[model samples]
Target: MKKLPVNCPSCEKSLVVSQLSCSNCETVISGSYSLPILLQLSSEDQDFIFEFILSSGSLKKIAIKLGKSYPTVRNKLDDIIERISQLQKS
Candidate 1:
């Protein structure tokens, strides 16, 4: 499935979840709900996090899985951490 956008394309502004639906029941609900800061990250970052979870947050495993060096993976993780910190404060 394609990821839903978390930001406006033209304005590059954060977006809120205004509507939700149930695929099973076709029930629709509408309201303004802020997305978690994590969801606001880029899809690549989100995927990295998913992989991190799959690896049980093991940086070594993540590095090996991605065919990257441990330092590279660690730097990626540091960047993710910085982004999360900034997002949480906003």
Candidate 2:
């Protein structure tokens, strides 16, 4: 499946979910819905989150898997955490 776009291509503004349809019943629903905070993150960030989960939230394991120094991985995670906090506030 194609990744969901979080921004408008032309204006670069964040995009909202405006419509959804049920595949089973063909029932359509329409409304302006804000994208979840996580979905609003870049794909790379999302992949990091998936990796973090799969590693059972172990920074050491994540660092090993990414072939990165432990401090670098920790900084990356810290940055993600800050981004999430800001997103939540907005």
Give model 2's TM-score versus the native structure. Answer: 0.91
Per-residue lDDT, model 2, residue 48, is: 94
Candidate 1 off by > 4 Å: none
With a 3 Å backbone cut-off (N, CA, C), the pairs that clash in candidate 1 are none
The 10-residue segment of model 1 with minimum total lDDT is 1-10
User: Can you give the lDDT of residue 73 in candidate 1?
Assistant: 94
lDDT by residue (28-56, candidate 1, tens digit) is 99999999988999899999999999999
Summed backbone clashes in each candidate are 0, 0
In order of appearance, the predictions have TM-scores of 0.91, 0.91
lDDT of 2 by residue, 1-90 (tens): 798899899999889999999999999999999999999998989999999999999999999999999999999988999999998887
Query: Which residue runs of candidate 2 sit more than 4 Å off their true CA positions?
Result: none
